[model samples]
Target: MSALTGTTRLARLVLRRDRIRLAIWILGTPLLGYALAGSVASIYPGQEARLGYATTSASSLVARAFNGPIHGTDLGAVVVAETYVTLALIVALLSTFAVTRHTRQNEETGRAELLGANVVGRYAPLTAALLVIVAANTLAAVLLAVALAGAGLPLAGSVAAAAAIGGVGVAFTAIAAVTAQLSVTARGANALAAATVGLAFVLRAAGDVLGEQSADGTRVRSAWPSWISPLGWGNQVRAFDGERWWVLALPVALLLVGVALAYALAERRDQGAGLIAPRRGPATAAPRLLSPAGLAWRMQRGTLLGWAVGVAVLGFSMGIAGDEFNDMIDANPAAAEAINAMGGGADLINAYLAAMLGLFALTIGAYVVQALLRVRGDEADGVLEAALATAVSRTRWLGTQVLAATLGAVALLLVAGVTTGLGYGIVTGDPLGQAVELGGAALLRLPALLVIAGVVTAIFGLLPRWSVVLSWTALLVFLLLGQLGAVLELPQAALNVSPYTHVPAVPAVDPAALPLVVLAAVAAALLAVGVAAFRHRDVPS
Candidate 1:
């Protein structure tokens, strides 16, 4: 039999397994750009507004660091500038997760071994996964092009923008493939691949921030750092301003090299093992590992720590940007007005801080879902069932996960709040005071995070089969409503459905007591119902 035997059948099986997931990535990735395209007209209406945006954004280090360099004054260029980094990150994530799920995860679960006993080739699973991701990225690119064109952008620039996004996806698919070959566990592969994506973003940001501004102050020529990142290559495509078709060659080359390296490395390693072996663990279990709570903590602590570090970085960066907001507002009053509208406070600095805090809340909410889903994984893998056979009760097992998730989220918030305050306070010469105030603001976001946790727990108990998909869908809906509701011009009634919509933008305005109380009580009810249901229902044997 040929080495590539049964590849097509494995590809079909992957498609069948991940249909919903693929659909979400393909559709949702494009929709983000379309929504931003539709809103850009209102956000920056005329040429003057667009020019103002280009100039201000191009000149602001904070803007450049976060969004990349602005290309030109055209509305299409503005759309690319606004959405490129965000959409590229999403696409990259979609690619990594899809690849790792089908390859490393399959190996970890012994599915690949079972298939290997048949006529399946050594590279069949990896090949099938990459093919699926390529198809998904192609469909997303086409749909995104159509969406942007429908939003009134020129067709050619839209296609270029879509292609840029797709390139990032392709490049990261290769990166994940390599990481899959290198890491023994699926989680380690995912983390390694994701950290690479994060590194790309940072490199792109650094390049843009350190680059030279153009004569009109509406464009920046990025430094050498950008040339090394896939994101930088995508940005260099310059979707609207003189679309550089050649820059795409970089990612295509990276994809080829990465895939070749992956396959070669795979041949050297034994099946279900990685080139980089995991560190040896202690022979005996720790005393803490005796309980369900302890086991859950051991499984989840690494994830929590990763999130905490990321939050700290974000908070500190935003805190430092706090000092820059005044200069940004002074240079462009129109932009200041936009910030005020989004943040809802008269004081520009406070408004900016409040907006950053909301972002912190969203991050915490996502972390909560991820942590809870790990518990779902335990249940799905029958690990929870084994634990239950012992003296451990169902409530203690499920409740421990919930409690750990809650406390972990709280710790992240505290990290975010303090780091943000510390960063700002150091710049303003009042570190202690700012830390206290910002830390409180971060804590205020806890109720919304809890509401999200409760919903996920309830789903886990009531609809275990749909728990993963439904939980993510819920979080995505909340993110859309909370972040884009105003931009999308949705009705207040519709926006009210998100728990985050009720959380007051603290420091911007004094928060009312009633909304926080209502959200907390609702969260409590959901947690109670979920726990009760899990106790009574039969575990999926």
Candidate 2:
């Protein structure tokens, strides 16, 4: 058979395997973008209102850093600026992780070896994975365009915005492919790809914030800094301003160049090996690696640290912008109402801080779930079997992962609270009190987060194959309910299904102690049942 033979067939197989996953990625992201755009347009209906909001947002460095640079005063531009950067970040990260996992990860685990032995081409797996990502991202772009245009945005701008998002995904997919060839393991590839995107975001944010300030009292309007980042290039397309379509060429060129480089590297590397070979560690395992708990910590510590740093930075930046909301509330009554709904308080800064903390808490919950799911990963890798061969009991093995996850959750909550409180307190002149108050507020949400982690553990015990999907699906439902339910005006009964809805807004509002206690009790019970079930079941072959 030819070296490129069966590539198209493998591509088709991959599409069939990933049909639901692709749909979720493509539909979920654009739907979110469209919803946010429509809501912003409605909230600031008039041109005057849009202009006022834009001017206010521009002054907040945190806002400018998270969102891209605001262009014109139109509602469309404001929506694009506020929403597209985030959307692109999400899409690109998802695409990269998905592609790298199915391609290089499978190869590293020997699954691709089994498949490759059956008439597959040398490069078919990588090619097929890239094709799947491209197709999914293309669908996302088309759907996003339609959704935005249908929401009353101009056709050209909407399409350009969608194309920009797709370009970002394509660029990252190629980057992931290249990293996959360089790293020996899936975790390494994921880390490198994620870090690249994160660094790009930070750079783009720094460049945008700095570029926004007047140097020597003269405003700089050049797109130079933005042009250096893929994300910035997307923003420079100026979707709602004059429709700078030529900017799309940059990401396209980068994607092509990245893919070519990846393929060339692939030809140089051997199957199941990386361009950069794994570095050998100590000849003997560390004393800490003797226990399952220590092993779990060893595996997850890097990821937790990365998340903590991101959360801390995000909290600190948002904290610095607290004072800006004071001015914003005075200028815009509608914005004030939105802030009030998030956390009912007379002090707009406190309310904003409360809302930001709540959002960060949910992210902390996601990290907790991923950490706890290391049990599933261990089971799949046959590591659990090897450990079981020793004197270690199943319960003990499971307990190690669960304990690590719980502690990691607490660590993340502390990091977020301390960072946010320190930043806000220093500016407001009440350092110690604010830190204690915010830290306590973050702690209150832990019960709900633990409850979700317990649910994942229970699913893994009872239905191993369905565990990851169900857990992730639960997260998606929570996200939609928490974010979109308010916008769609959904019933309180439906909204209350999410655990986050139960965590009372802190610092601004009085704590609801009963709900927090109940959540904790539920978490403990679920964990008990899951561990018991795991003890009774035979490990899947």
Best candidate (score: lDDT) = 1
Which is the leading candidate under TM-score? 1
Q: How many clashes show up per model? A: 0, 0
lDDT of 2 at 374: 73
**Residue 365 in candidate 2 has what lDDT?**
74
Worst 10 residues of 1 by lDDT: 330-339
For model 1, how does the per-residue alpha-carbon lDDT over 1-541 read when each residue is reduced to its tens digit? Answer: 8767888999999999999888888888878778878766677878877887888889888889988999999999988888898899889988998999999999899989999999998888898898989889989999999999999999999999999999999999999999999999999999999999989989999999999999988999999999999989888999889999998787789888988999899999988999998999999989999988788889888888889888998899899889878866765566666666556779889888888888788878889999999877888778878899999999888899999999999999899999999999999999999999999988998999999999999998898888899999999889888877766788999999999889888878898889999999999999988898899888765
**lDDT by candidate, in order shown:** 0.88, 0.81
Model 2 spans > 4 angstroms off:
212-223
Q: After superposition on all CA atoms, what RMSD does each candidate show versus the true structure?
A: 1.4, 2.3
Off by over 4 Å in 1: 331-334
